[model samples]
Target: MTDLAALRAALQLQWALGQEILALVQREHLALTEPGQRSGSAFEFFRQRLHLLPRLEEAVAALRRHRAAWQQLSPALRRSDPEIGALLRANEDLIFRILLLDRENQQLRLRHGLLTVRAESHPHSNRSTSGQFSALA
Candidate 1:
């Protein structure tokens, strides 16, 4: 396929993956907020993401290859191609939203006792911890 064709395909895949991941995060956010839905909520979010992992990896590799193709395209072409430009714009918007949602999810996790602020985050404490504790730090 042509470089333009490949770039288009890669952008499409990236957009799809971003949407799916965003949906998963949104679901996790909703799960965290709802009352009386405690059983297996975290596990369900993990299971969906785990199932998406292979597709995500494959898309990453494809995008890496496409990155070279994108670089090969002339700046004029990049500016002129409406579909490619729109896809890139949409991808950027989706990324911004996903980040916002992920931050909200993290705060929700903290509020719901699924996460702790960690020792380092505390102003007075210099204590060392391991595993999840270290992760939070």
Candidate 2:
């Protein structure tokens, strides 16, 4: 296959991988938010997603390396490689969404301390010795 064809294929693969990673992240959030849910499945999904990282990175790197060659292609060739523009736009949108979701996840982790809870009946029922609310109280 031509370099354009290879790059286009790579872009498609990366897009698919990105979508999978996003879905896994959403699943992880679900695992976090549900009161009785187990996080093991989400952790497994994360492990699977991690296995895909190097392939995704290689595909992205290959595209970057071939970008100069891509710019040299004729307009017709560029237009024929539809994956280029579509993947670019989709990637941009996905990246923005992923960043927003990741930030929210970080905040959730900090706020709930990974959803840890004590045997106390009420959240405000326990107070520290100084009359201050603390997670460890």
Candidate 3:
């Protein structure tokens, strides 16, 4: 059917776009790690590289729509097209795993940031305690 064809095209386009965005992220990450490359602050580098994640998510959502449409096809059609089913399932799994890994990485980064802030603030507490008695006079 025409609708099926359109969905397939859309899914393929979404997958290709996601791959392209991931490639760009990889390239930017590698460039940022090169020695003596004082291109920008770490936060700025991370911001630029991370900008692709939302675009990837959008592409994954589009692909999921296509996959749902494919699943709703008649049983006979699905039985006759095993490759479509397999590819759809595989891509879905891959995207889901990527998103899960991204979330875990974000959580770890947040924990690291909290630890860094705590370490930086802890020394100030010692200084404040040492001066507290003198200031109370």
By lDDT, who's the top model here? 1
Provide the TM-score for each candidate, comma-separated. 0.65, 0.58, 0.53
Sorting all predicted structures by TM-score, with the top scorer first, yields: 1, 2, 3
For model 2, the superposed segments whose C-alpha errors exceed 4 Å read 36-72, 115-137
Global Cα lDDT for candidate 2: 0.57
Give candidate 2's TM-score: 0.58
**lDDT leaderboard ranking:** 1, 2, 3
Please give the distance, in angstroms, between residue 49's alpha carbon in candidate 3 and its true position after superposition: 5.6
All candidates' lDDT scores? 0.64, 0.57, 0.51
What lDDT tens digits, residue by residue, belong to model 3 across residues 13-77? 66666566444434433434453644554465356435655666576666667677777789887
Per-residue accuracy of model 2 over 1-137 as CA lDDT, tens digit each = 35766777766776776787677667666766784765655346445545654654564555565555667778898888777767666765764565466546544654666323442334465442212111221
lDDT of 3: 0.51
Give a tens-digit lDDT track for model 1, residues 1-137.
24676678778979989899888877777777886554446656656656765665565556556555655778887766668767766776776686677667666777766665662265555442122122121
**Cα error of candidate 3 at position 93, Å:** 1.2
Candidates 1 and 3, the one with greater TM-score = 1
Candidate 3: RMSD over Cα atoms?
Answer: 12.9
Pairwise lDDT winner, candidates 2 and 3: 2
Worst lDDT window (10 residues) for model 3?
128-137
